[model samples]
Target: MDTILYPLEWFVAFVMVGFHKIFSTIGLNAESGWTWALSIVGLVVVLRILLIPLFVKQIKSSRRLQLIQPEMQKIQAKYKGKKILSPARSRPRK
Candidate 1:
């Protein structure tokens, strides 16, 4: 698991270090605990901002599925109790 997640860990460390550099350059004390904590908060905010589009897309997809649920239920009802045969088992049609 650690090997699988090594890249992600590296990316997270890179983001935190980059934010720490930025904060330090803006006059925050490099040795202060607040500086390190703020870097974590900044990373969270940045990641959230980057994921906004994916979150919106997921919401839209779920909404579409919800809207189509009635039709899906109707199809399921129509097919209820029917045995689905494979093509090789089915008779050829005229």
Candidate 2:
């Protein structure tokens, strides 16, 4: 997935640079790199805003998992004896 998206990311970066250059040639305020930088930053802010709910959900899930860790450990310990089988007996009969 990253391999596919990498080129697109680069393309966006190149387009931003090209846009800055073109605006500079046109004697507009867009010549300032900050225009492009701030636009990218704003885009990130919007995306983060959109993901806030998902982020909150993840935090809640993480907290719940933390709370359950002790119980999980207890379950693991209860199953520990069954998990340790002799090496010869561990092989499948097939």
Candidate 3:
């Protein structure tokens, strides 16, 4: 949890700073609701850009899984097992 604080702060600060700069350039106050709205848009665009590669990788992964679907189904059909048994362990009473 502690490790996540820096990234969270960085993202928030990034959006705020971006908003401030844009607002300053456009002669709008940083505290305006419109400024905040555009800042959120800026954040969304930045995040989308950053995640593009990950999204592409995920798409590729899904395609690979799709390709394997037939084989997986065949394996499941072969297994068509009723139930799986596992060794049970006793828990101590409090």
Candidate 4:
């Protein structure tokens, strides 16, 4: 588990460190706890911006699927009384 999480941990730490550097360079109190907190908040905002497009596409796809679901149900209802034969049923016993 540690091995699997190592890369993920490193990635999160790297993002935090990068943000810390940005704050330090801009004359912020980088050594203060609030600076670290702001770095984390910044990461969240960046991630949300990146994911907004994906979230919108997922919502649109869901609506399209919903529109087709009734048609699919109608097709299923059309065939509700039909019977299907299996190979075992078509074979004779010894």
Candidate 5:
């Protein structure tokens, strides 16, 4: 995962540098390192905002699965030692 992420990190750094250069050209106080820092922070803020909905959906789905876990376990126990498609046989059919 680190191998896959390294390039992505580099790409983000490159974009931030490019953005800093553009801001400098526009005379937006980009001469200071703070401009690059703020750009990266802004990017993080935007990404977090975008992921909020996805995070909420994941939490809801996880809660629903938790609610169904007991019923799923009961089902497993009820079918224990029984052939799923052959109720009259003890061994599984070939």
Candidate 6:
């Protein structure tokens, strides 16, 4: 488990440090606790910005699925109680 998470840990640290550098360059104190806290917040904001497209796609997909739900239900109802013969059952009797 630690092995799998090692890369992610590195990535998170890299993002935080990058944000810290940016903040420090912007005249924020390099040693202040608030600077570090803002770095963490910056990381969260960056991650959310990166995920916006994925979130939009997921919402669109959900809406499309919802629109087709009635059709899916109708199909399910049409097939309800109908016997679905398997390959083994469909074979001619010996």
Q: For residues 39-93, write the lDDT of model 4, one tens digit per residue.
A: 9998888778888999999999999999999999999999898896799997898
Q: What is the TM-score of each predicted model, taking all chains together?
A: 0.73, 0.56, 0.72, 0.68, 0.56, 0.73
lDDT for 57 in candidate 1 is 100
Candidate 2 local lDDT, 1-94, one digit each (tens): 9998998788667766666666556675864766677556655665578889999999999999999999999999898868678888999888
- Between candidates 4 and 6, which one is better according to lDDT? 6
Candidate 6 steric clashes: 0
Instruction: Specify the poorest-scoring 10-residue window by lDDT in model 3.
Output: 84-93
Full-model lDDT, candidate 3: 0.82
Stretch of 10 with least lDDT, candidate 1: 85-94
Residue pairs clashing, model 3:
none
Which pairs of residues have clashing backbones in candidate 6? Answer: none
Give the root-mean-square deviation of each candidate in angstroms: 4.2, 5.6, 5.2, 3.4, 5.9, 2.8
Candidate 2's C-alpha runs over 4 A off are 1-28, 84-94
- What candidate 4 gets wrong by more than 4 Å, as runs, is 76-94
Report the candidate with higher TM-score, 2 versus 3: 3
Candidate 5 on 1-94: residue-level lDDT in tens? 9998999788677767777777778787966877888777766876688889999999999999999999999999998998665565857768
- Tens-place lDDT per residue, model 6, 8-78, is 89989999999999999999999999899999999899889999999999999999999999999999999
Q: CA lDDT of 27 in candidate 1?
A: 100
Give model 4's TM-score versus the native structure.
0.68
Model-by-model lDDT, in order?
0.96, 0.76, 0.82, 0.90, 0.82, 0.96
